[model samples]
Target chain A: MPTHRRIDVSKVGDVTVVTFLDKKILDETGIQELGAELFSLVEQDNRRSLLLDFADVDFLSSAALGKLITLDRKVKSAQGRLKMCNIKPEILEVFQITKLNKVFDIRAGEAEAIAAF
Target chain B: MTDHISAAGWQRTFELKSDRGASRAVMDVLLEQLGAHDWEPSDIFAIHLAAEEALVNAIIHGNKLDSTKKVHVDCRVSRDHVRIEITDEGQGFDPASVPDCTLEERLEAPSGRGVMLMRSFMTRIAYNAKGNSVVLEKSRAAAAG
Candidate 1:
């Protein structure tokens, strides 16, 4: 297991659960660091079946969405799965407005996401 | 660079560098003032997200993060309304020309969603002809019951 800063990594029945550590995911440098760490899960650790829980995240910019889109592509190319859960209503509105709800697998809670995966 | 409180509202102007840190600092003060004026959390979130997208567009897309170029921000927060204008020093693009990110073929693209997000969240968003300058506003009266 490698040291992580932007996300907390845990496992639930072979599925990797990742939680964001920041309330606001807007800063460019921070978003870059976050993207690298997330990509490393598939690139470095070779982990499949990832779940992103956004309970602690209160805000995110469009740049952050860009990273998630790239990560979804990576996971698909790697033949793995990616899902997200616990997104706040306002943040969920961002996904809806961008129509990203159709792109990524999103669940209402951690258990539901984990079960789906 | 100038910030003051008037009987009508709180106002501030900032000449920021083409750096994310500088922009984040400016956002902090804007958010704090929104809170001080008793804006609802949901409204605050909308303003925060919209302002951030506009700032990033001005800094990264408009100014290209040029150290020599500066991004000018003008903001006013009142009990029933909030407005912010951001302008960058660059050869601007036409806002109308930005392809819709929600298009089926363009949905997966990693970029080009900033302008769309700004338009969706704010009560009104407008760009100057040069496209280097943008104004974002939210009307609390409209949002409230």
Candidate 2:
């Protein structure tokens, strides 16, 4: 298994549950590392179902959003699934503001997100 | 480099490098001052988001991370509102020509949403004719809570 610094990886049944280690995902270097770790799950690990739990994330910038968009594309190209949950209300407003709420599968909780996968 | 405090509010000016780390440090100070002034959490979040977008745009897109270029920031926080102006030393682009990121076909594109988010969160956002300078203002009452 490759070492990861920006995310915590676990297995819930067949689904891969990834959690962010940073509360604020605004720094460029951090976002780049995060994007690499997320892309690796699909590109190297061949994880078919991925669930991103944002329970620890308090903030994110447009650059972070760009990473998620790229990750979503990578998963789709790999014929995999991606879902996100536990986004705080403030961050959810960001998704709604950018209309990204329509682009990804968002759920209310981890259980709900996992079940959907 | 200039910081002024009065009975009403505080103001500070900074000349930052065209680097993310440099900009992040400045943002931390701004957020700290906002908290000290007892700004509402939601309002702080909005200000932080807008400021982050604008700074990143100036540092990355405007200045292109040129080591020689500097990004100037002027911030004022009053009881009722906060205003920030960021100017970069680069050839500016037309803000009016920025495509709408919320459009149906453009929804999946990741790069263009920064400008839109700034406009949505700030009470008012204006860019200089040169396009390298931008002012972001948010009034407490107008903040989307």
**Tens digits of lDDT, candidate 1, B1-145:** 7778998999999999998767887888999999999999999998998899888888888899899999999999999899999999999889899899999999999988888988887899999998899999999886674
| Model-by-model DockQ, in order | 0.90, 0.85
lDDT of 1 by residue, A55-112 (tens): 9999998899999999999999999999999999999999999999999999999999
- The per-residue C-alpha lDDT of model 2 at residue B95 equals 96
Q: Per-residue error at A68 for model 2, in Å?
A: 0.4
Off by over 4 Å in 1: none
TM-score, candidate number 2: 0.98
lDDT of 2 by residue, A82-110 (tens): 99999999999999999899999999999
Every candidate's CA RMSD:
1.0, 1.1
- The C-alpha lDDT values of all candidates are 0.92, 0.92
Per-residue lDDT value at B20 in model 2:
73
For every candidate, give the share of true A-B contacts it also has.
Answer: 0.90, 0.78
For candidate 2, the lDDT comes to 0.92
Which residue pairs in candidate 2 have backbone atoms (N, alpha carbon, C) closer than 3 angstroms, thus clashing?
A: none
